[model samples]
Target: MAKLLLCSLAWFTFPSFADNKPLNSPVDYLSVLLSLVVVIAMVFMLGYLMRRFNVTQHGGGQMKVVGSMALGTRERILVIQVGEEQHMLGVTAQNINHLARLETPLEVPQASGDNFKNKLSQLMQGHKGKTDE
Candidate 1:
């Protein structure tokens, strides 16, 4: 980050070949539009790369939180599974700490496809049964 800042400062300090004239030609406008497109594409490509590398960890996959228990209003104990190993973590408002590493992995149940849909249908059916009574 410092390097980038320094490089940018250096860039502004250096002389440029650009005339700094106002855009007057269709070719100049086209060039500006193309540059804008390229910058936008680069931004999207960077986002794709970040998601592909799991940098943001948006979805549950190999690493997932198995369970969590709240200790206080601001603190909790969490069990997270990474690959086959399960780890206990202590989380607070300030920071997170690793509590322990489990020798035996905890079994987590897998949800069926359309889990929310199934749950909602079951609730609707239960409501109908009560009203029919």
Candidate 2:
């Protein structure tokens, strides 16, 4: 077991020793930093060019998220408007379910300050209070 441990230790330490060649010339920290900066700049440039050319996006028709409500810690209910039709979906970490298709679609909630939370709570409450007709 000691022999195995020694062998493993030697194997790990071997690379450090191999790479420890005496510096033939002074290490230019500035040049190394400049090269790193150039590489990062090149990556950003390429990303910008790709985005400018729209290379990373697949063309799917836009679907609007009308509204959403959090049911629990990893679960949500979403109302999505695709084209003219509206869909209510139950979303969880596990999977999504089709909840209902509204006959009379609910109005899109107006975005407000802290009142948005109040509106959301009220909306959820209203959903619970009202029965399906």
Model 1 CA RMSD to the hidden true structure, in angstroms: 12.5
Global lDDT of each candidate: 0.76, 0.71
Cand. 1 Cα-lDDT: 0.76
- State each candidate's clash count: 0, 0
On TM-score, the leading prediction is 1
TM-score of each: 0.42, 0.37
Give the best candidate by lDDT. 1
As for candidate 2, its clashing pairs are none
Locate the minimum summed-lDDT window of 10 residues in model 2: 22-31
lDDT of 1 at 114: 54
